[model samples]
Target: MSARSEPNEPGARAPQSRTGGGGAGARKDPGWWGAPPAGKGGGGAGVPEQKAAGDPRTPKRLPPGGQRGGPPWMGAAMPAEKSMNFGPSARRLLGRLRPHRLQLVTIITLGVSSVAAAVVGPKILGRATDIIFTGVIGHQLPAGSTLDQAVAGARAAGNDNLADMLARMDVVPGVGIDFDALGRVLLLALGLYLAASLLSWWQGWLLNGVVQRTVLRLRADVEDKLNRLPLPYFDRQPRGELLSRVTNDIDNISQTLSQTLSQLLTSVLTVVGVLAMMFWISPVLALVALVAVPLSVIVTRLIAKRSQRRFIAQWRHTGELNGQIEEAYTGHELVKVFGRQREVEAAFAAKNEELFQASFGAQFISGIIMPAMMFVGNLSYVAIAVVGGLRVASGTMSLGDVQAFIQYSRQFTQPLTQVASMANLLQSGVASAERVFAVLDAEEQTPDRVASARVDGRVEFEHVSFRYKPDKPLIDDLSLVAEPGHTVAIVGPTGAGKTTLVNLIMRFYELDAGRITLDRQDISTMTRTELRGRIGMVLQDTWLFGGTIRDNIAYGRPGAGEEEILAAARATFVDRFVRSLPDGYDTVINEEGSNVSAGEKQLITIARAFLAEPSLLILDEATSSVDTRTEVLLQRAMAALRSDRTSFVIAHRLSTIRDADLILMMEHGRIVEQGTHEELLAAGGAYHDLYHSQFTAAASVDAEPEPAAR
Candidate 1:
């Protein structure tokens, strides 16, 4: 589904806010619209001030040149990026061809045949040279052309040998020409080129089919790998960075296969075939050309090795810039609030400049290979011409052989330049392939065997210890139990590990120690499908995909009928505002339901949860964003839904969870107190202090006049 956005086109007026019944239609600013770029800091208070790349300490900062840097977002707590082994990664990429062995074998067969046919061109052209030469040798009569003039001049100078050499013709008075041999040689050369071209076309057609199939499987594997990987893997890496690996990296590999792979095969064949023809024609000339071969190799190797780093840097900068765009564009509103638009743009420009420099260095450095190869080739050509001319003067070599040797030399040297360019492309392709393989080889979550008996709403966390990282243990040796059909409200200050506890219950993160069981079964023992199927979560974010309201509501149970969906909506109080809209339940929601108010989107999520009717319900700050009046309505609706299920509520607004059956007052990573609201208020502990602090603060804010700026 396409993301719905308001028209910011030129001349378009800004949208007006609807201030209607119960003030529910009043416009509200969405605090943050997107996740931050994933990096080491985890989007905490300070983002390490966006350092430049190259400095290792600043994990996600762009250093001065923006050559290469870590993921900019700290939203995902992904593991630190690791360097890859090129050889193994390339081997793994080649192994993908194992599945399409037949097609590959055919393409290679066609390539070999095409090259063999192509090789005949230089040799056959040389044969045509011999024919033309023999036709002209030792016979003179056709006098008008340069060769005729040369012979006339030689005869005038009284040089019989020079005259015979210049006029090497064997035409009889009546028969005149040996057109038969000349025609056959030229026609044969044309036929060979035509055949070679046709064979290459067939090979390319087959190779394209093979490339598409291989890339298709590679893309599928990357997608499947995402599902198998643990949530932690996604935490520290930006989605954009991973997207670059799956799409841009894989696409690079496919392109190389289509372009470089065939060129590589043809270059090797052309080089070998040309050398054979050269040696057959003249060994001494062949030796002169061979000397340039090593020079070309050394020059190409030196430049390619240096260029490889720049190519890697080019891709690295690309991933970083992609992450920057995603974060900045998606979270445009947050940047506006902070007034960091200029800063964001500056960071982007710096990263873009780095990417440009890296690409320039990679391309410019490798680009020199062709010119360098051509220079060496020309030197060899000069040496061959000089040596062949000397041999011809000594009567040891014919003009035709010398001419053929020069042609063969050009063919041999041409592929070396082609090979040089392909080598550079191959290096870039291999770098991309390694990134793709890195994603494929990432650690996967252990497979679960679903025990298909039954699960009650009873949940128990026994001495469970867990942490995002070893340095800071978020939850430690915690024990809790919620019997079937009970309301467990977890109340705490921000960063009190409230959401972390919810994550543990849902098994989104594995426990560091101990066990969490549902009924008598360990939650980890069941497949995530079976376990999560019974649990319903409505986070504060209230995410909504781009679709009709009906589609979004029915996402809880995709095949649910209209009546059931409407019933769920009515039960959750979503039907109240939904009916006020002209389109009713069919009203289109934008990405994240931006078209609707925050409270409205929240109610829709409640309706979805109502439809699911899960055995366990988790609400993490489900009502924190709503007004006091709307909160009352939602609380009433939630009470009805919680009638026959075990529900866990994490709330910052103490008033909302006041009536919860049991309130666990938490601080740090443990529950400091647990009781009913009234019981806690009477006890005068952390819960009492927190309840007073929230209400007292609200009361003071209401009484105060205009406040001064911080």
Candidate 2:
């Protein structure tokens, strides 16, 4: 059956409109990351030019193309984001952090030292309490003079146990209490606290550096991985979500490291240190404190098990929301024109609500751990006071020891409570790390082979076959040849594998079967860099960075001279409008080229192609943006540009490609007809039908008289 014009009808991809690098996917009008940034060049009365990407704290950007943008507004429903298993994610994160082991060890050491000093202060304070009590009980020595000599006399007689006993007695038994001893013990306790504080601050400062360096390396890795990803990867994934992983997810990990790492180490150390001190003072009371441990652990486990899933869901929702925000923000103009703002807002609300719920649940559940822990801690405190009071009355334990044990018990539970509180946030960070690892673990593009010299433009597709998905073949056993310096026109309906060919030629996709060659050498054997360097393309859609007009044009040949840049701009008619602008070629084209028209963005791409000066050229609807007269001029300029280059022009307008030396009419991934325009028209096949259907319809429209004014 003869194919029909349906590329723009519905459910079809716009040509070469995927991905961008204009900083947040602003690559022409109506782009996602490459989506329409200004909303279809559309700003109806109610349509806003830009919508919020989401909360400012969570940064996101939409790339250009056909993807959706903007977050769910206030109340429409969207699916909740999904969660993943944590084991692999956690292990992957550990692997990334392993290189920083030296820094981590230093941090842990400082953390332990600081916590240990603090833990000992309570025990020292208890000695001050004992001194004060003894003075009130009249057990103080007379200026602490006599017991010192008795201790030395006992040691001289080789009675070490007697010396220890003599040291326990006051200087003059039954004299006054030791006020001087109490003051010294209290001062020592204060010193320990001050030292602990200093060490803690130093460790915090060091840990910050470690996190910064790790995340910096992580970002670099992600950027490199993006370039290595296959085109099909972008085709399937959302740019905003990927950006979330690269930016938000990494930041989450960074935040967790900075806030939770030192605290975690301190909490663990405090638990151990306090437990040891409690046992040293009185094992009976220490055992009472141990009672709270199991209860606290059981509560934390119950809450964390549930909170972990919610935290994972929360991060996932964040990425999903980011994707939607990128879509809505990029295409906000569309929402207004189509009267879908309410719908978009509803969607936004739904997504926002979902994120809110996930976050709330994770936090609320984790929040329970602290209070629950504190409750058990209070119970333990009561139990200790009761047990220690009985021991003190029985003379089995000293009053000072009981007081210190009580303090140690509180200190012990304090860290466990803190750790429980941090559990949810740490889980969130781990989940985010897992998301990042997914990108790092994705199948990278096949490494390029040996670099080759400049292409001669002789190309052949021999028995090639490919499919985006295994069940849906896009190209099958297709074969063709393009002689040096010859123009080839590829015409096909929507989904007829027209644009897919460009992807294949540029090595954006690998072939499932067969091979392509250039100048008798297989293209697959050459590095992608070598093959792409020799080829230049001006796609139907255009991409311009956030820079001056001159920068965008010279993107293909960054080292191009001013003279060369001007010549390319002049050739593409960009110089004409550029001169009209205030700054001429230096005028900045904002991201998405929102400051200019769509056609103008396309023309910039044409100028970029000219600057590249490659041996092979592919123009897919390259001149579609210009009017009749402008297109004629463009065609002339393109002809001059293609003088010695092998060119492939994929166009819907037969007139633009009438001069093509060979025309291949494609349908269902197969070439149904091949010949020059004159030959195809005479044969009255699919090509003939397409031409007449287009021209005759246009003629009839032109022939119709304008309706008479009322």
Candidate 3:
């Protein structure tokens, strides 16, 4: 049965309208990365106009992440602003590590055991100090003097304080150093330190594994999320920004876990162990050291609070700057041809300056943390030293105990300082985590039905309505049917929704109202994978990855035989050009496929589609880049491929679709006329006018007089 148009459509004079860039006419509008049109306050939006190709000022397209713009990793560090809810984001980040809980527990145990062994070393050394000091004092006294005699001698000299201190010392008068006890004490201290070192090393190794595995899982989730997200979500976001989240933000999270997680655990453990030993040796001195805790906290919080905002700006600007630089470099030729180099540079300078200021502020503020912490620690040290000396002289504490207490005081404050210093990395990492989490939390495409049906060549759009924006309708209550084994050609003005029609058929976007079916079965009920698997598409934008020509062709059907690959190549005229190259079918396409001409690339894509042998085919300006001769050959090849299969061809050049079984002339998203090419021309409607306008223009170009020989 022949397709029919809606009855409400006008017979002549198509309406003037504009949709998004989906239409060919909308090509004049700003690109996705660009501002809106001029009338909507989009002019002079700092983006330059695209210039014509081959201008002398136009620069050659540079390879992405090539020497010209450094590697992608060297782009501004992809940082994010502070998370809106830091606590929840941090918890979520930690949750990523839950899978490695056993390893984490082992690491924590090692950290605690290491701290306990390390904290004991100082106390043991203090015991050795006591032995040396007691022997020295004893050696200075008279030979064979008794304890009572020493006390009497000090009393005779009116040194009662010395008498009391001497009474507390358990040293024999005139005895020299006890080498045996000192040796044992030194050996014990060394053993304790050695144990501590070994445990800490083991802890570090385990932590590294845990962190990597967690990050690996996180990266996988991000990759899966991107695949599941709807196409419209991608359209609304910047490509560079999305890339930053995937690469840079995930990297930051990994680094944060590696550097801070272990350190934080160890530092807290050290603080607890050291504090306990300090009180055990001298509670009075422990109290004195505790005085610094509140002060240090205040200093850290003040500096961190001020720097947090700067860190947020610093990372936010970093992502923005990276995006801008990427866009500018990608379109470097366009910027140069339009003489917008200065404008591009000026814009870059502004973003660069903002990044610099933010980085400087964040660093400058956070940098003050260590010094402030040291100041507080130093004050506590001085007080402990003075009070310890007085207590030792009064015989309330031994010189060995005082020495141990001072060492414990330093250890106690040092860990607190270390914790304070981690504030910067912690904040930056959490911010990055939030960005990654945002992607994971984004809405995904609707899930497929539990059961899927097979598709044949027939497809039908039933009372379909759709829109890009809520206020502006692109395709309204449109209905069409494509029977089995027929070619349906769609032709319209640029914004007449030609591309949108094909997109809807592919289910790239969902309908606001109505249903589409395949062989009388609703397409929405099938899994996307199953639905897309049955269709082969040759797009205008040819994409050839970095691989051999043979490999690229085989991509359509992963296990396709060599003979099948060659046959498809021959059918699409790809084999001829490929054979002339040095390597024939084995010729390698570069990463950007710059090694091939535009027409050759188009042929390669067509060959790939041919290899698929799909039930349905879609060719959207697939032959537009090729010369007239090549186009004619490709049409014949496509005709063979289209035999006994449904094909949808969207084209602007009228000559290519004259033999189509069905021709639909669309205007303002409605199908105003549908008939065979001859029928449409005979009706003298919108298609009639469009067909003459293109040929008339082409005829005038061909009729121009030849120029005189120079």
Best by TM-score: 3
Residue-by-residue lDDT tens digits, candidate 3, 1-710: 00111222111111111111000000011111011111111111122221111101111233355433432222333333444566888998998888888998899899888888888878898898889999998898888889889988998999988888888998889997999999999988888888887888899889899999999999998989988887666554544556656766677677667767876787788778888888888888888999999999899999988887776676567556655665566557677777777766766787789977887777678767878887898999999999999998988888888888888887777777766766777776787788788899999988888455766788899999988788888789999999998999999987788777777777777889999988998988988888888888887766676689999899888899999999999999998899899989888887556789999998998999899998889888889999999999999999999998899998888889988999999998999999999999999999999999998888999999999899
> 1-710, model 1: which lDDT tens digit per residue?
00011111001111111110000000111111010101111111111111111101111434456543323432222234345456776788888888888888898788778777777676677667766665555234443445567667778998866666545543332233367988998888888878887887788788778878989998998888977887656554665566666666676677667666666666677677778877887888888889999999999999888887877776676666655665565567777787777777777787679877987787778777868887998998899999988876554677777877777777677777777766556666787887787788888887887763466788888998877778876678889888899999998877677777777777667888999999978988888878887888887755676688888889887689999999999988889898899999889986535789988888888889889888889887888667789888888989988888999998877878888888998777888999899999999999999999987988999999987889
Backbone clashes in candidate 2 total 42
Worst 10 residues of 1 by lDDT: 18-27
Ordered by lDDT, highest first, the candidates read 3, 2, 1
- Pairs that clash in candidate 3: 25-494
State the RMSD for candidate 2.
10.6
TM-score of each: 0.83, 0.84, 0.87
- TM-score for predicted model 2 compared with the true structure: 0.84
Give the lDDT of residue 634 in candidate 3.
98
What candidate 3 gets wrong by more than 4 Å, as runs, is 1-83, 698-710
